[model samples]
Target: MHDQPPIPGRRGFIRQVAGTALLGTGLAACTSTASHGDNNDNTGPLRFAHGVASGDPLTDRIILWTRVTPGQDNGGGDIAVRWQLATDAAMRSVVASGTLTTSAHQDYTVKVDAAGLLPGHVYHYQFETGVAKSPVGRTKTLPRMDVRQVKLAVFSCSNYPFGFFNVYADAALQGDLDAALHLGDYIYEYESTGYGAEQGKQLDRVSEPRDVLLRLEDYRRRYAQYRSDPDLQAVHAAMPFIAVWDDHEIADDTWRDGSLDHKTSAYGPFKLRKLAAATAYHEWMPIRTPDPAAIDRIYRSFDFGSIVSLHMLDTRVIGRDQQLMMSSYFDANKQFDEARYRSDLYSPRRQMMGAEQMAWLDRQVEQSTARWQMLGQQVLMARMEYPKAVVLGECSSTAYVAAKRRAALDPASVTDQERRWLASPSLPCYLDSWDGYQSERERLFAIMERHRKNMVVLAGDTHNAWASDLFDANGRQVGVEFATPGVTSPGMEGGQPQRNPDDVAAMMTDMIAPLYYAQTSKRGYLVVTATHEQVRCDFRFVDTVQQHQYTAAVERSLRTLAGPGNRKLEECPPV
Candidate 1:
């Protein structure tokens, strides 16, 4: 029998963190500082670090973050920023106070997690530099498990060029989110003129660098360009973000060793591009990634007081193959021969969370004691429909037939689900999702069954809104999925998601009973709140996304209680 790789627990991670410079970049450098041209903030400079922000939202307290740049250089600089959290709107009655030191290393980003406070509490905060102060901000703590109400603004697939982030801007004004979970594809790495799927649309935001990102410089430029968006800036300024990424952060539909658009030979190579994207992500986002040796450590858990536990899944980088199509062929037992399953989907070594990470995740979900355990992820978890006959049998027929034959003869795809397309729902083809990894899907299902816990998956991607009932292998209802529309990214509804929108949501609601709710061509986010008894999701839509504003229209509402893990459309349990 072949021995599987041993799964390392949290302690193993700590050891790995202490022992190696995971990414091969020395630890000294991970925390090192580069010299900036000059020191400009003698008076508390309002502009500290890249910007004032926080992430990893939890029940008791949220992580308060800020960085002070020395000048033009981002690598090195130091300053002190005072942060305070309060319970009232007036900023009186300070609850948490701290002094944070900014250093040249870690890009001068100062992160201090404030803990030990009330659950389900909404707090106002402010950051103070010598004389400059950040705008007053508001955040809501997660509820304890016994608490019966909560709300979350779930979002994903935000591409700046598609349009303005009216979704986020509007989310900020609505003011009822316990926290906003950004499920990834936060930014795209395409050139200024647009590349790949974003190529044809008229761009809404332009980046500083106008090329595909393959090097560290390219990645950094991409992030900086994204940060420069005023609407994006306003969203960040308004509330703390809980975020992760999908393929666009690096390349489209990326797996561990390859991507849909970038072949190993095409962008120099996978390792180089991966490193570049990873480095830039660490330098830019308010999230965390483990050191290279500790690459298995990224999947983490956050307790929203006692009521819910938020699991942020790292599906893109750690281990995942570029998603595959079901159009090809498989064997008698619904298995695609890993060897014969050609294309990026059939590589025997292709992994979604990698073996170790998956095992770790299994443990996290199993050990959770919270009432509602939610996976704040980057893409669709429930199965989506694609008309295999039209997409595979007809649309790209000749080429598809040739590729299918080539993969069948390949030795790597034995038992792969190459032919599952025949059974999958007929719809338009979306090549960048879970439909590509059926085996991985089964493995995850087994884990969920073992735990027998109530699970709700919240996501963004597809740039649309959907509410789905999750099914197990036996087709038994297992969980619920609420996908919030994009903050500003374009949807299948063209650039005008709100246009002729009268029938799309209804059409979707009619087609998929399990997936009973939806809204498209609508810009905005969902406000999610989970309680011991139920999870509430509010689809907040904005009237316009072309400019900066906080105004939002509450287009719809949906809720799912803990009866049998299926979602039911109704008002969320009130806090």
Candidate 2:
């Protein structure tokens, strides 16, 4: 949804080299001896790791991908890359095989769409760059229409700068995922130490970007830095990923109007940086170009037959306003002076999916024939109540007075109660979520109401897992939300206040019953399994994120679709 840059002569070379080196696919020598260097050789010695992967599961076949290492700089010669897909890992019977050429043009990443595969079958796939043998990868096509179960590991917000991808490693070891959905923030936009926190150990690698992303090369390099991460590579090789992005893929808190990272406050003139980020995102990610007709673009539907139909929505770009950086209480201090801090969270025109995406979502939901409709997206859907106890200048007359009871938190967090009662504007200040788009959130809930069908929303990017029973305008139950935590990035309430997961969970439960379960400071992903009767989200957590080796535990949540408006959801200890 952004204008492409004019192809200058030099820019042509940059785009030309995108194939192999840009994506870190083609390597001639080795990632081991060379230590994941920039050796993009087009010919000879093409070696690579992270094996072949497939995604966007269709009935018959899936897309296969791999990166080959060529020699020391050509990004791999114009060598031909061949792939084989067999029902057996050892290639007992050749199911689908093909040969594709790789060059420095594509950064040596070979992605082939293997057809003629039997649906719902496990297939072993492998890639070969000349004489160099690549690793064997396991992939599966989406089940046929009659299948009953689809289990997936859904994740997002993996910052290489944070730590090793232990979460990815864990999921890979789980050895049981139909498809893995990586919901954006696959890479971060920061250099070392630029983003607030740092992992226990130094991040294995730095951004291919030495600085913030402003131009095309900078953005491309950013991906390079992240892809160089071995654990990330392993995960990519391990399974197929259906992905979407949130802000920080470009810059933090971006919208139609500029970004939170901008220094000038005078960028409205050219909109150069914003456009660049969008262009790079399209070129780098496997996502289709934002189709404007679909509303602010990026609202598309994926049919998983009669059981589940996934509508993945793009939250950034389009109609969203520049994110509100501070709460009204916090804003009050800045509103008196800083023009930028003063923002309208309730601005009627600002949107989450924009008018275009909104309308598209409406149609997708209405026409869907699937028994379950899942919206795979970014951001939270249920209304989040911060510690703010004030409404404008007055106090809340509602019975939410008990809501002010702040958690005996890590003693580090400013609870909503502490803020509202203490009038500490900084306590529980949360303007960064869907609360910033009240009107749009309301509109979407209304759509679910009209469809007379049950809905389930899956989300990530928050860095903390949450299970909530969604309610409509009338405060009646409508749907449910399963918000996955981060892969490596830490959440708002990590062990900072250092309370037990269950104790903190109890505080959260006391704060909001609809918000059934939450784990503030854990690292891992969510494994969601859906059947005709119920959609169960297993919020899987790793014991520790700071270490390289960690195990996962799950907090299970369930939602039953009795009818359209009769959806019911609950979070309970895993059975």
Candidate 3:
């Protein structure tokens, strides 16, 4: 069934590229901090409260951020903050220095885009106001055009109350990452006591607002509570971050208009609540904005030298239509029919990236000059299927069995029915991912093929590690995908109530054609290395998140060619 729906009307974006260019030129020209006098002194109370961070990196520019409070308490009101970026740690060779005033409107947080630094070079930055100074943060710009390699640390799903952010500290201690990528769920919207009672009590950590986040102040305080974590701060202090929002950043299962957790009936208006979340996110995080008015347009592209182009996407908000619910597919008997079940599933009208962003993505890929293109977005783009045997073995719930049957996956003991159920391949494992929007997934593959771009997709949110081959609808290989495990959020093994997690992952890997690797139980981040030759991804898992002190190991490593014909993938022996 081929369905080609008309593209939706494009929402206008207020591009700030020209204005930012002029500001960058001015910032780059300010090469000394001598004129600032005693402003750089640091022998007083803590004014720079939240420490320092940098993000949204470019070849010649990067954004710097810090929060300033007047007193040691959770203070309010406005204060002047001074920021300086230097080529070295000594603050002797200052490249850019500026002063900005922060008020309660922005929650006393400050963000500055420091430009004119040399590419592929390490730099030091700090924020100061009065006698208070922030901890010095290390940051770097994107590599030059001829650079050889880049190493990135990717993390996601950091639930503060769930456990200690040991994974963040672990990645920071690695000490060799050029930059970090946050694939969303940076802050969950759940209340402290109910969601993570045991861990929160053990860690003595509680979320702000004391309830589920809905108001602007509620979201702001939640971010503040999370930023107060020492381990999270250390990770931010260690390197620049490229971040994008997922469903939890606003609320669970968020789309363009509403969310699962937040409803217009309860939250007053979806737009207001969403704007509050987005506003708080921008205020706390050090991200560059092309236009302040158009906050939802976060689909941007960055170049990591000539080796790779990083395309960051906003899949949860701004674009996605409402997700297809499983309840809608069930029949009167809770039974299944293949043709009727898949009709709505493959609807051409179901949009994922939306119309405008999809067109924008096509242009970005088509005009790219880099050797390899990498998509940093939330949700898995690979095909995952749960075999009938595994389902029957692991799940005993009648409701689950009914749902499977409703999806046309009959597991009757009859030979033909069982055989067909087991042999029917590539069923949707998780509807929350790209599987839910199969037509859009196929459309992206068509775009990649039309542009002749060899791409790699980096995804997180399932809290599991995965390696899969991306294929077009015609079964032609398009690219590869590496999905990182969550930083602290529980995974399939420990989080869910299931039996034989390892067996399920192994079964999927064996039965699924596209999937080469799968680890359902482990919790860790991904270390990605890109070069002219190939891109290598290492899945590093830690021993535990329940404790602050834990050990880590690379569970698996996989690599794919940069410029490819057949696009062969190689898995190395884990050390």
Please name the candidate that would achieve the greatest TM-score relative to the true structure. 3
What Cα-based lDDT does every candidate model obtain?
0.60, 0.63, 0.74
Give a tens-digit lDDT track for model 2, residues 454-526: 7888887677677788876477787888888788776745322443445545545554547766666667688
Candidate 2 whole-model C-alpha lDDT, 0 to 1: 0.63
Residue 312 displacement in candidate 1 (angstroms) = 1.5
As for lDDT, the candidate ahead, 1 or 3, is 3
Per-candidate clashes come to 53, 31, 0
Give the alpha carbon lDDT tens digit for every residue of 509-530 in model 3.
5555788877756677899998
Q: Estimate each model's TM-score.
A: 0.73, 0.79, 0.86
lDDT of 2 at 527: 86
Q: Could you report the Cα RMSD, in angstroms, for every candidate shown?
A: 13.0, 10.4, 10.8
Cα lDDT of model 1 overall? 0.60
The ten-residue window of minimal lDDT in model 3 covers: 13-22
lDDT of 2 at 33: 12
Can you rank all candidates by TM-score, best first?
3, 2, 1
Give per-residue lDDT, candidate 2, residue 143: 67
Off by over 4 Å in 3: 1-46, 72-76, 387-418, 495-501, 573-575
